[model samples]
Target chain A: MTLTWDMQDAKSTDDRDVVLEVKDLRVHYATPLGDVIACNGISFKVYEGETVGLVGESGCGKTTTAMGVLRLVQPPGRIVEGEVLLDGVDVLSLNEEELRRVRWNQISLIPQGAMNSLNPVMRVKDQIGDAIQTHESRAREAVKERILELLNLVGLPARVYNMYPHELSGGMKQRVCIAMAIALNPSLVIADEFTSALDVIVQRVVAQTMLDVKDRLGMSMILIGHDMGLQAQLVDRIAVMYAGNIVEIAPVEDIFEESLHPYTQLLIESIPSIKERKPLKVTEGLTHDLRNPPPGCIFQFRCPYVMEHCREVEPPLRELKPLHEVACHLFEEQDGKIVDISDESVV
Target chain B: MRGLTPGYLIRRLGMFVLTVWLGATLIFIIPRLAPSDPVAAMVSRLLAQSGSVEGSAEMIEAWRARFGLDAPPLIQYLRYMRNMLTFNLGYSLTSFPSEVEDMVVRALPWTLGVLSIATVVSFVLGNTVGALLAWRRTPGLVRTLLPLSFTFTAIPFFMLGILLIYIFAFGLDWFPVSGAYGRALTHNWNWEFVKSVIHHGTLPALSIVVTSMGFWGLGMRGMMITTDGEDYMILAQAKGLHPRRIFWLYGVRNALLPQFTALALNLGLIAGGSVLVEYIFAYPGMGYLLYQGIVNTDYTLIQGIVFIMIMGTALGVLMIDLLYPFIDPRITYETR
Candidate 1:
């Protein structure tokens, strides 16, 4: 539940400050059956001017976690426990008026589906201008100039401002989305699968633009995606989530080279690379049903090296190395039994 | 860009021709096949007026033959189609000197005016209310009002029209009981006439509004509910868009697309008019003209009214279709 980052180093070394720090965040959806624990006690820190990669499988609660951070959860899904501290302010505790000020000013989000995300009736420029005008009491000319600047920053021409969402290409639309997200120079940007819908080439362009904007604006980001390769390319640090829990938190290099958790190890190994033609190693079984999760480790059902004790008790995230934490029974004991299996048995 | 493909234009023209042919056939055949003799009805009306059967059966048969009622159903249908294509809707039996097209021209504008105004009023008010309800975290009073509005929508337009007439006309005496204008104003286009027209029109307009607004509100509310959950709406909120801006621009704007299509459809019906509303208000519109046509079995007048209604609907749909690309460039015939 505790997240400790070198704040002094992060502030002094980087132009971007520590924008958002989520501690022991727990979000659950109340369903007819019962409460489905979507995000169960997760913690991470996003420093200013850096992109933190949140990589997980489809049902690993990545999107839910993002929505919870924004407090945009619809009825039945609520943030049960969490401290979403944005620039030292607890976003969860703010009143509507205070939260309204904080939301678009401190943090902005680039949603997953760029294609049908825009209002079909409105011009692209107007949509961006709308964002600016809503947050700030600016003159029309100033807002228009800012919108054009944002559009240009995202590699869109000034002409696109007059065009409706449907007129723009997928890449253009995504850029418009990015422009919208960065309109107010928000301290932190949460892009939930923003580039997942684009082709690889477009995805790369969008991802690069995001990084470029972050660098220029000095805004922090949480880039959520399932592609490990994409995450490795964009994010400075990676938090690999598995079944509502962050099993591994480390720098990009450590996650790939010295992955401690079995889930993180499996994820790293599964990334298709040019150097190796080995078949991808995938984690076995589906994500555990959150409504009635087993008493022990949620990943125990899918873990290849699950022991008898693993099914009886849960494992706490313990620091395996400097700035690297892993939550798994394999790393729980000093001399835990080590078992090696090929890709066939694991799958 | 050519705006329309050649194939699309050809297909549309072909459909238009087919629709007209079908309409002509149905109008001609259904009346003939109604298991009642129009000649007998005409004869009965003459007898009722004269209080005696002065003409011979042969004379009555000759009159029927002159009108082409003596022909077989299929032949009659084909003849009607030919006349329709040539813009010759023939003479009204009830009003012999007046052509069907003339009667339609006289009555069409009134219907169009009433229904068009009603349609526009309902769309704007309903959508605005629905969007507010969807977006605002308003108090219980506003929330309670929404269900009542929905209840108004559930009632048929005719029932609502009657209710409005009772309350506003009979009970309150605030508006005229019937007709488009007061007798005192008498065809004048002055302020007095305008005021009287507005007064009389209120109950009818209210009837249309109360009946139809609910559908639009419900539609807009539902659309907002779904659209509000969309990622972009959340993105807008995260962008620190003021709550009102988020609702109107992000939430309602996107939600209005489908409602626009529905509104377009309703606009098509404006020329046709609300038959029940017209009857209740005794409004001199195409709806009442249609009523007279049916009651008198005025074949030519009915055909003319039907043709005009068809053309109005076709043109409305076409206009809406043409406007789609301008509104949302992603939409196109090719995409479908």
Candidate 2:
């Protein structure tokens, strides 16, 4: 059975069926003090065969959201409230057995730190074969054959199957991880900082391999990264998240060119490009703590174009133009004010 | 086979020589430094009982000459080293009628047999239990059982030996109380004698097992927990491996590597049996032989037993060093 769904509104001409839909997701971690709302009522959707880039600073709940979807969160950190509908079924509602069936077969995760993810004592082939044997019923010989096929798919020679993890280089290990993630041909794959550990040159190759795999497998991806330039080259749509809330969602070109949200604009301006010889503008103030989020908007302290209304009341996400959404009071007409402030005041 | 580096081997050999020299000095000097001369004491007692000085000086001189006690301390030490090099372990002072070699030869096999069985059983049981508890998010019953198993290891071997004797020998009467065999067969080497010997050896063997089993279990458990946290285990899970496969193939296999080294060390040190435990159980093992030598001041027998223990431990360490590269390809004798 094909496990895929659509999440695009009827207004857009590029409406593809949604592969995954996350609605009103509220995942809180019970700390010593109280509930630290990691993902506070956040919502988004990914369409079939589309790459959605989740860009945010550290501790902004991007990684937590991904882990929550996979049900990989350990104790004290939990998905307190949410609907993670994969295809049509709510993943959060599934029991352990049901979760096991869908985990690698329907949706796979390329976890963070690829280099350390493999067993040093085991042969790489046996490690890969383990996954195949877990979700499928096959003979030992057949599993061995499938492992070889997977190695070939990930651009690794079959010889790597007999070698241990320590024998392989960093790049080779990451490739093996990629191969392992796609061993089951899952419809949706989440690549969580997969290329973050490699050198710049290796990162490029690994990133390109991820894109190539997605193209070949015809799979949708939720690429979570802090590197905006890398995401621009790979992801089809970018969702700019700050303090556990996506402040902007737009096509890659729109995000780079006409970013409606001030935070998104600042983020894009910060990226060092050859043509843009201007000094890279960095947003002032560190990322806010998610435990006790500010009164209204989470980004009020860091937002350069923050208004009094932005601090007192939260701005709901509103469409500024076709296929572009922003959650800022300045963009909307509120109480007869255009709300555009002078550039000096923001500086 | 890289073996040990030339420099490392030289260092180890130098250390071995130094240890032997120090051990010999301490053994000989402590006896001499005592307030009373043992030979003089023996002669004085003999005179007191007989009430005669007839052949007293000649008898003392003969005793001194026979054992090389008449020589200077340095000369005696040199003679001891020469005899050690020639593999002539000299005669026992207590077992003057019988040779020290005969005593050690007769005791060695019994000690090895019981200790070997106990060590192997403890390792298997401890490691299996530890691995299972570590790999599984165990229930409260298993958690309770684990701490209780560790309790057996916490008690001293000799104390446990006495406890087992009181319970099994006196209270419940399941096993024989003491000795290698029943008094019925003195010269018989048949199955009946062998069975009785094994039955009597059980309590002492169990004492060693209880005292050492917790170490293996705790080691395996710690290693398994660390291995579980490793990237490879997560990778295995990510690869869609079944929980069982993850537990055995990834968890247990990697965890067993360090535990194997501990087991090998235990095997090497087994030659030095628990002296107190052997005494309590009255088992005719090396420990009992060593204890008898110490009590009777049989320097030759004590030196012989200590030498065997040192060699056994050294050989065990050497075996582990050689086997390391075979078990873990990442480890290299030259590099690390």
Candidate 3:
């Protein structure tokens, strides 16, 4: 884990405004086949009151990274090494008792699969109330008031308070989940695939609700999802992940306009936007098997402009502009020369 | 809070009629189809009482007509159902004119007392233990208990009764091996009679509880295990609720739903009594009476016992269907 990582070239962007800073987060799952490196040394930061979208296709460790942030990774899948600093406190260093205090009060997760997440036998209000009452001793009326406030914030009616999970529609359940996530006013809320399960109409409503709640409550959020279009609508900055690694991190407009990484460009092009309706640029090759990933770049096999050195060593994430980083040899600065990777490496 | 829509109630009541009618039809046909003519059996027993050398043909016909057995099978079935519905089970053929209703009344308390206590005790013990086992799942403790509980369920009901009687009654001289109470304690509301009833009921109740508690425990344990791993459970943990509250309230409460319905249905069938277990212990419960009814070809008694059982089961099913929705907010009695 102490392997030499080349971050000296890039200026340290760690600031007081950073709500959460995850450094070299690695998570591995011991399956029957082999150890699957679900998240491999992925690092990112979420600024206070800013929504950072972790975008990737399925099985690319996007969700794993979110789990690492919340310290919710369970048995068989262990967070092997990482330093998760939330508000400058290392959450990873906290023991079980301390983690409980940190979990819902400081950082909560609106988990994936909204349909199966809430307790079917419990009322939605109690579900939210339980999260509140767990950390603090509050009067019954006080808890009820807080639950009502949360429900209102998520755009759900007060009538939904007494209803069970099964009685609610998918959209309502997701709202309840979001309500629970924000019940304690956690400084950071991670919504994993918050709207993926819903149809287009419900997705838009849920996305709107997410924005409203985030803006109103003023909490940093990490929205992990597969839909780039949906992520683009909600997040200020997007981190594009590919096979347990983030290939690019840039503002949403910058990613859509000019992406330095080949994978990022391919991902942006793959989105079927009405504005970018030129042609369907199909990304070729297959996703890397996490158990037996290649020695060099995980995206090298799928890169349209693959180079010799791309197959030899992995490129480190480097800042090409302020707050924009790209992990590709194309952006590398060699000695005093800005190496023309386009002429030498474009295949 | 729809309060069970009228449509669901009426529909369920209609189904109940169908079920009871089916039960009555089975009872009506089963005796007629049997080789032993109950009329003939009653006639012979009657003739023997009178010290007749051989039953005359005329006498047999007279007795058959008197009992309405000479009519067509359909008319006889109708008459039988009318008698059953009116709670007049007629005279027991083997018991020599003793009303089947009276005999049933005499035998019911013995079975109910033993079984109700056993079922309730075991249900409480099994479910609590099962939940604890699921919550505090130490591998070593589970490894030791899993096999023993499974083995208890594997042992046949009567075999376990006999084994209990051998170990606790005949060997240890701890309890009476047979009968409802002490012979010296006359039937009364006195403490001695009640104490004797409980004292004698111990072995039979123990057999029932010991054999079937394993089922409830294992069922609840399995339910807890599956429900424990569910998304709601993870959500509970993420909620940062205390571990104890989560285990009992969220974990066991959901797990206990299936077991609750099962228990209600089983307790509903308690009217039928533990047949072989009661017979082995000689606790003259409804099961013992039913056994005697079958052996003596007492169709009236058999029909009476079976009707009670059918009614009990139907009521149990109906209660679960309608009342369970009220018990569990997840269930809805509204017509889909």
Best-performing candidate as measured by DockQ? 3
Question: Which ranges of candidate 2 are over 4 A from the true structure?
Answer: A1-8, A13-15, A139-141, A275-277, A318-323, A333-347, B1-56, B68-88, B128-136, B185-194, B334-336
Tens digits of per-residue lDDT for model 1 on B1-336?
324566766777777667756766676666666787766777888888989886658768988898887888678777877788888878888988788877777777778878888889989999988877776465678877776876777788888788777887889887778999877667867998888877878788888887788889988888988988886776676666677777776788778888988877778778877788898889988898889888889877887888777767777777777777665556666534
Ranking of predictions according to DockQ: 3, 2, 1
Among all candidates shown, the one with the greatest TM-score = 3
DockQ of each: 0.50, 0.51, 0.67
Give candidate 2's total backbone clashes.
9
For model 2 the local lDDT of residue B199 reads 90
The sequence of per-residue lDDT tens digits that candidate 2 reaches over residues A1-347 is 01111222534545577788888787889989888888877677788999999998788888888877777765578888888989988989997678878888888888788888877766788777767777898999998888888888878888898988887988889999899888888889998988988999999888888878888988889999999999999999898888778888888998997777888888877788887579867778876676888787778887876778888987776655556767777774335333444432221
True contacts kept of each: 0.69, 0.56, 0.65
User: In candidate 3, residue A285 scores what lDDT?
Assistant: 88
Estimate every model's Cα lDDT from 0 to 1: 0.80, 0.79, 0.84
Q: Between 1 and 2, whose TM-score is larger?
A: 2
Error at B74, model 2, angstroms = 8.1
Extract clashing residue pairs from model 1: A17-A48, A104-B240
Ranking by lDDT: 3, 1, 2
Docking class of 3: medium
| Candidate 2 lDDT, B1-336, residue by residue in tens | 634567766775676667656665566566677787556666777788889878888988988898898999889988977877666778876667677778888888888989899999999888878887786556778777776787888888888888999999999999888887897888578998888888988888888888888888888989998887886676555555667777887789888998878877788778877688778888888999999988876667888888777766766776676678677756665645
